[model samples]
Target: MKECPQQNLIVDYVFRELDTKTKTEFEAHLKSCQSCQQQLREFKAAAPVFQKARRIHHPKRPAQNYYKTLKENFYPSMSLAQRIHEWAADFFLTPSIAMRVAQAVAMLVVGVFLGRFLFFQEPIPVAVKNETSPILAANVSDQFLRHYLQETEMILLDVANTNPAEDRQILSSVKQLAIYRQLMQKTILCREHAEELNDDVLANLINEIELILLDLCNTEDENLIETLQNVRRQIKDSHILLEINSVESRGI
Candidate 1:
């Protein structure tokens, strides 16, 4: 005999989970459904045995009602942030392997962010006429732009050489994005310095590199090949690598 669709609802009915209308519909169906009826009867008959076994294996233990003892003082009024802070402090104070690992990770993350914030500010504007010599300022600018160009050239070369068809795993690589972000941050600082020095050539080159990096970072996996091809074309047509080498050789 075929099983009734409502057979599964028998458990819900026994546990009083169904609402009134659905419960009534299930009951009316139960009167005419012999298979569901027999199954329900068997389940009800076996429930007492299962409960007895559960009680034997896992008897209840008596415990103190600390909340009742503390009464109104059980939960002190505190802001959500304060409560969360206290809870986190209590949880990490516990001596467990997972807690120790989590605390270490949290500290490491905080340290990394703090270090970046402290060290990665934009290059300080050189005091051209007042404090530093013109030659010294020029050398600083040259070193800054030279370093930026070298790093940008390296990243571009890597992207240009990547064959999406052969190296499919490049789509999921984490180091690529990390390098992109690092270069992008440096580019922002470089652009600021370029503008300060009024070097249009260096500023324009920085702009182009920034756009390429932004595109590379935002490209979706499906369009990664196309984006890479476009970036290579931009780099080649602009003679970016040749320009970088020329700038570096001439001391920017």
Candidate 2:
């Protein structure tokens, strides 16, 4: 069957973020949806693992120039003022970081006006072609790909370290489940965008991780605890994290 339209809403269902009426409708929809059931199952299985992960993590970053590379991709020809302003606006778009409404609105307006003025002031010369900067573009693209790969690796590594016997009980708590659901939602976006970019290597690794998340989210079947135990084993066997490190060093 094709993926369910209600798939994204399942996150809300897990977190109790839905209103009474919407929750009622979602529960009804959830019953027949095997895809969503799998998502829920994996979320349950992964919750405690993620909860424990707060105390365990390794910070990994790509080249420091990645940000500079990202900025170059955005406003290669724009004036400095326009470029700086838009970069600031990008931070406001991040939901994790709070931006006051008044500040965001003012910055947004300034950005719009600045952008319009910069691009229209002079007779717009035909933009230069990428023949001179193909290598730069490729570096930038790979930088983004590696950044995402590192993220998936860290999250999976943390999930893998969880012990099924102890974490199984914690998985059932409402709070743990909500956090797990949120992490999975972030994973969904990462996986989807990677696929859109046709980065098969990164996408395939993430898909393996997604399979585990889906299986863990919905099941309290204590019988599946064995399956949960194997989650870490599966990640190590895949050697995906090592592969990412290799790629990074090789400058892919």
Candidate 3:
């Protein structure tokens, strides 16, 4: 089947990521394209399956006390070499086929537990640490700042391309508003770090972004279009998107 260029937007549409104008355009395309319609139907059909899979309860593992007992009984009775020899002989030379298979399975399970007890250490929660720390604060790297800028750019594009006439909900969207609040808070955190760096230009740009986010979050529905237009103009005149791209490329 010939592919439609608009098919790529189907995921965004299903996820409600597309801004109003792009979503309206894609919906129009969806009406005309059989392939995209079928794909969308498939996506909808698969949603319940995924939800059910997520809710599935997995079988619980043996308790720690079970392992403790296994360790006490299995490892302390003999020397390591004697245990290995006995295990090997029991596994390979057992006259009963069922007994040999049981021994093999037990050995496999025991080895896995033994290896875990010997070498497994709890992993450091790096992502948690990064998230809790301010961007570029202390030992945190500049990657979080780059990621924040990229997300801001995407939100800005969504705001810029929104059609005021058709997408009256653009400025009032609950999801978008929530995202704006989050980004604004993150921007404030980033501003403190930016000030510490002593780079006036970087600090000023972040300040501008914070101001834009504030306006976006606080604009009244009655003045939505005017606010959107002003925002688009501000973004274009300042070339903020280009600056974001440049900063992303040249690391802080």
Candidate 4:
């Protein structure tokens, strides 16, 4: 029979399924013929996917004697030179244990520095003027009064932006805004009282209330009228907190 054509042999040769003689002949033909060489390249590219598919569909099973043969072939003896080489490699190439110790020491130093900076620093004392001092009292009252005026302006601006058609929502937002304004005014009055008594605690409380008013004025959400009302209630509650603190501070 005549020899099989080279083009058919290309696929078999690409997949390594050709006999030795046929493979030899196919490679020789591939060297001489550019078309056969190109065909071989194309077949080589397409053969891997088919090989993978065959492996997936028909996986090979291990022989029963594989582990027994493996154990029998295992070498237990080592030459002196080989042993020395292994020891030398482990000593030179393995990572140093001291590196871990150094890292831990570094972290401890950083932690101690941060703790000292955060907790042990002394708070500077605030200077307090005499009770019933007119100048200092006037300054504290003016500070909180400015805060109250700013809060009132913000509330008025918010109300101006509300739609009159949505009367319920507008009224709710306006009522909450009014309550916050009243709280802000009360905070200003409290500042005057604090300045008259020369009480640091009351001054701090007034300052905190002004901050709360600023926060409420800055809050923006047409849908959060209820949440805003809660904030207003919180500001009202601050007054009660101030009263309780004032009574406690007087030793009564």
- Among these predicted structures, which one has the highest TM-score? 3
| Full candidate order by lDDT, most accurate first | 3, 1, 2, 4
- Local accuracy of candidate 3 as per-residue lDDT tens digits, 1-252: 788777888888988999999999999989999999999999878876887889766554747777778889886578889989998887577647888678788989999999999999975443444456443345334666677888999998887788777887756766567678778877876777778777677788898898889889877688888988888898888888887787777778
Q: Is candidate 2 or candidate 4 better by lDDT?
A: 2
Compared with the true structure, the alpha-carbon lDDT of candidate 1 equals 0.76
lDDT of 2 at 156: 64
State the C-alpha lDDT per candidate.
Answer: 0.76, 0.65, 0.79, 0.59
Tell me each candidate's TM-score.
Answer: 0.43, 0.35, 0.44, 0.25
Ranked candidates, highest TM-score first: 3, 1, 2, 4
* TM-score attained by model 1: 0.43
The whole-model C-alpha lDDT of candidate 4 against the native structure comes to: 0.59
Off by over 4 Å in 2: 1-151, 244-252
lDDT of 2 at 43: 78
Better of 2 and 3 by lDDT: 3
Which candidate, 1 or 4, would have the higher TM-score against the true structure?
A: 1
lDDT of 1 by residue, 1-252 (tens): 678777999888887899999999999998999999999999888877887787655333432455445654776678899999988877866657888888889999999999998888764332222234222333446576677788898888887787877765674355566567667767877888889878887788889889999888776678878887898888878888787777677665
At residue 10, give the lDDT of candidate 2: 72
Model 3 TM-score is 0.44
Which 10-residue window of candidate 2 scores lowest in summed lDDT? 124-133
| Least well predicted 10-residue stretch by lDDT in candidate 1 | 126-135
lDDT of 4 by residue, 108-182 (tens): 999999999888965332112112222333444545544544454455344434443454454545446555655
Number of clashes in every candidate structure? 0, 15, 0, 0
